[model samples]
Target: MTRHLPARTCRDCGRNRPNHGRGLCRGCWLRQWRATNGRYDVATGTGMGGPGIPKTAADIAARLEDYAFLRALNVRRLDIAARLGVSYRTLNRYDARLRQQQDTA
Candidate 1:
């Protein structure tokens, strides 16, 4: 006979959804992951200043240079994202920003 286990609630949101991991629901878990990961501006499609991320204009310029260099080397976008410690979507945003900057310059 199989034993029934008690239902678990999310520790962070106190929701009745199924636990994902660390006693958090899926939404809570994803929020936590994003918070701990790199900073990103969803609406603006830009990287936000935070720990271990580019903040100043010079820093952003340096990152763009690195990204351009990687592209020149024909590195796969996914590989570049991994090397830069950012998500693929964020890398796409960076690419767009780079293009915009190039167009204006």
Candidate 2:
């Protein structure tokens, strides 16, 4: 005997088809994945920007300032990253860069 699964409607297109998770059908899911350049998180359904914080000097300075303030409060690295809207790896890079500058000065 074969099991018959009920068709699921995609949240984006509303077409009935097999679900690919995140309440989206395969086609819609693939569309979203490509749209985000594969940054789509299937589990959280959010795309944390691939490159992370903008590369502008002012933006980097501002984020680093925020990072320092948050660090002074003893915030966890993960929390700091989320608050800064960056990934943990990016935060680590920022931290290292700041340390390097401080060392040189």
Number of the predicted model whose TM-score against the real structure is largest: 2
lDDT of 2 by residue, 1-105 (tens): 965656898889989887777999878888787776633122121244334333698888998999999999999877777676666667768889899989999
**Can you write out model 1's per-residue Cα lDDT over 1-105, one digit (the tens) per residue?**
954445589899897877777998889999888767754333222344434544798876776788889999999977777676666666777889989988999
Poorly placed runs, candidate 2 (over 4 Å): 1-54
Q: What TM-score, to 2 decimals, does candidate 1 have?
A: 0.46
Worst 10 residues of 2 by lDDT: 38-47
Backbone clash pairs in model 2 (N, Cα, C under 3 Å; residues 3+ apart or in different chains), count:
0
- Give TM per candidate: 0.46, 0.51
Candidate 2 to truth, TM:
0.51
Worst 10 residues of 1 by lDDT: 41-50
Each model's total of backbone clashes: 0, 0
